[model samples]
Target: MNADEVLAIYNDLAAENVPVWIDGGWCVDALLGKQTREHADLDIAVAREHAERLRELFARWGYQPQPRQDATDWNYVVATGSGSTVDVHVFEFDDEGNNTYGIEYPKDSLTGTGVIAGRKVRCIAAEWMFRFKTAYTPQDKDLEDVRALGERYGFKVPATHRRPAPRL
Candidate 1:
């Protein structure tokens, strides 16, 4: 999704009192304070308590749920008629701060605040993004994202992700 669409959704959800945290590649761009590439879809993390509200919002916007091989009740995707999609990750935390359900998102990982299109937005923290980017075998975009984060914030990137230059 493009920034305007993403922001519109964010604003709409906010108006309904459903908080959403931007995640994945769009999040990287949020942290970078600009859009680095075209985003195919938006990734968002919301509290489990808000999933129903989120679903209703999506339904109202003509976003149909897309079946997925790995979708759990707490995580799934919805796509609009225009091909804009959103990957929704629902999460919960215990009183002691442990992840109790859905994605294993630590509370601190959500502390990041960044700007998108000149508006402040909540996103996954850079350190957590760095760890997530390096946690698995990365695609070229992931490598580029990690390298960009490393270059911008002085995070330690794995040796393999230190690309010599961008691929043509």
Candidate 2:
């Protein structure tokens, strides 16, 4: 999805009092305070309890639920009748407010909150985003995101990320 569409969706959900955190590439852009590239889908994380409401909202927008993959926390994809899909990650938080095991957000990982295109948003903490991106085998886009985060916020990407050193 493009940035405007992403912002529109967040605004609509916010109007209904649904809380969501931006994740994946858009998330990396959010952390960097701008859109760095085009994104195929929006990645969002919401409290597990809100999954039903999210599904309903997307359904109203002409999205249908697709089957979730086995052994992944990803709840489902909301696909437009035209086949465009948005990935939704449903996560349960513990009584202590920790995102449950295998869920992406760690306790205290939401470091910055603000409004983007009039939609309020909470961004994945820079450190955690760096850690999360590093876990996978690096793609060119992933490396670009890591470098952008580092350049913008002085965030250091850990050695575990399979990306080569950022160009000087």
Candidate 3:
């Protein structure tokens, strides 16, 4: 999806008071304060209790539940019948008021907040994104994302997970 479409979706959900945070490639761009690349799908984190509402929202957009292997306690993708997809991650908060559910992101891993198309947006911290990107064998797209983050934010991802860039 393009930035405008991404922003529109987020804005619509925000208007409904859905608590969501941008993640994945689009999230990297959001963290860097710009759109660094094209995204095939949107990634968002929502509270588990809000899943049903999220489903209803997507249903209104012509998206339907797709078969998903439970990767964790709360992660899955829903797709439009035509193939567009949105990856959803469910999270819970700890007593310290830190996000500690689903994937284990350190409390301090939350970096900053910004506005995307006038809507307040939360993004995965740059350091944490770099850490996550490096934790996997870098696909070309991942390498590109790492390079973009480095270029835009001066955050260098280590070469630990370096791999040949994926052929576009």
Candidate 4:
């Protein structure tokens, strides 16, 4: 997803008062306040209470549910006929900031603020974003993302992910 499409969805959702926090690759770019690469989908974290309303809005915008192998009731993707997609991650946070449902995003992980296309946006915190990207067996894109975050946030990129993605 490009910045314009991502922003359009974010603004529309804001218009409806359904809050969301950007995650994944877009979150990296958001935290950096600029686009670094092309994205296949926009990932967002929403309160479980608003998940249904989020879906309703997408339906009105012509987006349909797109099934994936990892699909779950709280985590799934929706796509438009034009192929733009949003990967929705729903979470229920407890009074103490623990995640009680859906993705295990830490209490402070969603506290980040970023700029996309000059408009400030909520996103995963920089430190948490770095940790999440490196926690997995990274793809080429993940490594690049981690590297960028490292450079920007002063974190050391782990040796395991220091190797560059192989060139075909």
**Per-residue CA lDDT of candidate 4, range 1-168, in tens?**
899999999999999999999999999999999999999999999999999999999999999999789999789999999999999999998898888999999988989999999999999999999999999898989888998999999999998888756899
Candidate 4, position 97, lDDT = 88
Instruction: Indicate whether candidate 1 or candidate 2 has the larger lDDT.
Output: 1
Residue 57 in model 4: lDDT? 94
**All candidates' TM-scores?**
0.95, 0.83, 0.81, 0.95
CA deviation > 4 Å runs, candidate 2:
71-74, 101-104, 114-120, 158-168
- Residues 25-142 of candidate 2 have per-residue lDDT tens digits of 8888877666778888888888877777888899899987777555354456777866567788777778988777446577676665644555558867777777788778888888
- What are the per-residue Cα lDDT tens digits for candidate 3 across 44-96? 87776777798789899988767766654477777877667788888777788
| Candidate 1 TM-score, true structure as reference | 0.95
TM-score of 4: 0.95
Question: What's the lDDT for all of these models?
Answer: 0.92, 0.75, 0.75, 0.94
Q: After superposition, how far is residue 87 of candidate 3 from its true place, in Å?
A: 0.3
lDDT of 1 by residue, 1-168 (tens): 889998999999999999999999999999999999888999999999999999999999999999899988888999988899999999999899899999999899999988789988999999998888899988889988998999889998998777776679
Judging by TM-score, tell me the better candidate of 1 and 2: 1
